[model samples]
Target: MQTQVRVRGARRWIMFGAIGFGALFLVVGLILAGVSVSFLANAERARGTVVALEWRNDHNGVSRKNRENDEPVAYPVVEFTSADGTQRSFRSSTGSNPPSYEEGERVEVLYRADSPEDARIKGFASLWLLPLIFGGIGLGIAGVGTVVALATRGRS
Candidate 1:
């Protein structure tokens, strides 16, 4: 009886963990999706003047194999002045493809002023991509949690 109780407790903990993870993912996804939508709606968006551009050797999986071959890859990046008249720097990401311009090139972008990291240099902030991925994971977790919770509730 004691062994059975311990096993049930462990299962209960697993269910709780699943629900927790699911809720977290869902919340984060919804927030990101909301931000992306808002950025898309803005008129002026994140228009800026490119002041600088450069590349650094920050290792990534895409370049991991090349790193072993002594390959020095140049990552395109841009620094620009926001509408607020403040200068900041942003590097390109896989999410935003086809970098718009080079250093000293004036460009228009749509990014969150407060969090420049959450930005789309060429277009609107497409935070939706991450959110959608997370949301799908959340749904999967939620479904599993629901099943476990249902299955364990009566027995415990």
Candidate 2:
């Protein structure tokens, strides 16, 4: 009888943990989505050119396999003139292998008028990815937690 009671208690704890994690994810996802939307709403458009590719190494000085393939991630360095006519250069907030932008390539940019330095490549991937990814994961986690909690409640 003691062992049965302990098992039931453990199951309840597990259910609570799942629900807590799910709520956390959902809240974070909503926050991120809100931030993304706010950024998009107040951004100004600008024409910019990729001037260079900044390489970033994440190996922490540790030797690893395929050193050639492990070449640093390259983020584009963009130069643009703000609405006030001041020229500014900033590294892109996003990076990818094979590099999404090449040096000298013209690209559209979205920046906050108050802080042009906080600029981003204007596109679905760069702008919407964070919120979409987080929100999707949160929804999935919350759904799983709901299912687990319901199933365990019935057993209890």
Instruction: Give the top-scoring candidate (lDDT).
Output: 2
Give per-residue CA lDDT, model 1, range 1-156, as digits (tens).
999889888988899999999988988888878866777676345555655444455556656666654433343455656667776666655322234455566666666666665555664333456778888889889889989899878776
- Stretches of candidate 1 off by over 4 Å are 43-56, 59-90, 93-108, 111-119, 122-125, 154-156
**CA RMSD of each candidate after superposition:** 5.8, 2.9
Question: What's the count of clashing pairs in each model shown?
Answer: 0, 0
Report the error of model 1 at residue 38, Å. 1.9
Q: State the weakest 10-residue window (summed lDDT) of model 2.
A: 60-69
- Which stretches of model 2 miss by more than 4 angstroms? 59-69
